[model samples]
Target: MALLREEDRQYLENLFKENLKDKVKIILFSDKAAGSKLVVPGRVECPYCQQTREILEELVSLSDKLELEIHDFLTDEIIAKKYNVDKIPAILFEKNNNVLGVRYFGIPSGYEFSSLIEDILDISRGETQLSPTTKAFLATVNKPVHIQVFVTPTCPYCPRAVRLAHQFAMENPLITADMIEAIEFPHLAEKYNVTGVPKTIINEKVEIEGAVPENIFLEYFKSALKD
Candidate 1:
């Protein structure tokens, strides 16, 4: 009684194959009983939840380079608390005690799926394709940079912003990037004044709306560093 349809499974298999070419470990935190906490009533089962698990398990079984770990949030309170995971299906990519990248909420599916794969590649390679100038600027950054990018599922340009923020977080241990679904996290959207898609809030001070190139993103990072 798997949730995934055959077509979806095949599609996901192809995606996993294309994305995971090197060793990558995915730690998936989920609760069998609890639905997505971000959703209301807390009783509705996510249609994609079980299917996502199946897809990850299939990828793990087929690929020697990919390792998948699942934890029930109800049974593993300690681990969940340690990771400070408040959302369901949080994906963490770690290597050698260093948290290379984290997807705070759910799977980055739909158009964001490509962004998720890019994140895996970046973590696996231990490098991002950001320009040298961007790297040089980020290298001098010492303080914690928390970036929250608000996006919708249908937005085409949102992934670029999320990827850039994730790249920053992956390169710098002090940087943490969160991809917030505006509709899913309504309160957060209101709190951050997110009236448009791809709104990026850095360290609660500097805010940039719309998708921009890497250099523009770097400029905002620099401004946030000063605050």
Candidate 2:
């Protein structure tokens, strides 16, 4: 059985035909067993890895410009280390074989699905939908910044925050943004003290608790540099 509904598949087919431009490569890393040395002890088996793969397969089928590459989390240790992926069900987007900083550490379902679509379009076009002010601010960022947005798939507001962070990555090569599903990565949720959804941790220090606007997000982005 396909994870995507017939209507949804049609919608995506139309969307890709109209919006997708250049070839977009989606690299996925997953394993049947979720536990790894980096994950918390006794962590639950990856509840969404199979579903995530299904979704990617469906998505790639919608467009000729989209392609999927699957890798095992444990067996492909060398490749995972090269991309710095420490978790299963991780996704990395690329264009013309050049990987970008946009990443997802969990299944991008529910509202986060749109984030994945927009990211594909942005990467294909080699641009973003961010405001000029935000782009200007990102240009001043000379050092590396890591942004981790903890979310649940059902959270309605989480995708905005995730997309905002990803767009920031599109603006600057120094920015790396990830959308991490809180339920799949319990240890990460505890480490970041994520009691609420859409919690964004910048540079593992500056924290924002909601889906704030671009201006406010940039403020926190600047603050994270200081930490």
Candidate 3:
């Protein structure tokens, strides 16, 4: 049986056909020690697993822009440790030896799937779709900015915030964007007091809750830099 329903497969196919203009290198890390079992309870099955390989195989074959590289987390401890990967099915996108983006825990399914596609597109373009004002403000930023957006798989608004943070990180390497699944990493959620979806923590000091406009996000981000 296919992991994705027939309609879902066609939907994904149409998505790749319409988008995917630049090269997308997707590094998939699989934990052999936890093979076929989810590291986080209730997480989706690993695409490389026997039951789901066909689904991934079909998806990969449909897109020339996407390059999939698989690594066994247990065996390739060095690479896994380098990326600080402690979970299965992690994704890291890089270019010219710099980390472009990351999906730290599980598959970006459901509504988050569109955000995943936008991430790839933004990374491929090597630029962000930030407004001119936001771009100008971000250009003046000299210090490092680390943005972590905690989310759940079911949140509809989480992706907008995640994509904005990702775009900022992609445009400015001094910035790092992390999309943390709230339920998957309970400790993190508790630490940051993530009571709601789309919570953003900047530089461990400034916390912005909810999906604000890009300019508003930049204002909060800039304010954090001054502290």
Q: Give one digit per residue, the lDDT tens place, for model 1 in 120-163.
A: 77776678899988888778778888898888878899999999
Stretch of 10 with least lDDT, candidate 1: 40-49
Which candidate do you rate higher for lDDT, 1 or 3? 1
What is residue 45's positional error in candidate 3, in angstroms? 12
Candidate 2, residues 51-107: lDDT per residue as tens digits? 898899999999999999998887788999999999978999878777888999999
The residue pairs that clash in candidate 1, if any, are none
The alpha-carbon lDDT assigned to residue 226 of candidate 2 equals 87
Model 3 TM-score relative to the real fold: 0.82
Give the best candidate by TM-score. 2
Question: Which residue runs does candidate 3 get wrong by more than 4 Å?
Answer: 33-58
- Estimate the lDDT of model 3: 0.73
Per-residue lDDT over 1-227 for candidate 3, one digit per residue giving the tens place of the 0 to 100 score = 55677897787778777766667777767744344444665443444333223334555666787777778766788988987777666667866556664554555666666777777767666677888887777777777788889887799999999898988877676777788877767778999999999899999999999999888888888888985
What are the Cα lDDT values of the candidates?
0.75, 0.89, 0.73
Per-candidate Cα RMSD to the true structure, in Å, reads: 3.9, 3.6, 4.1
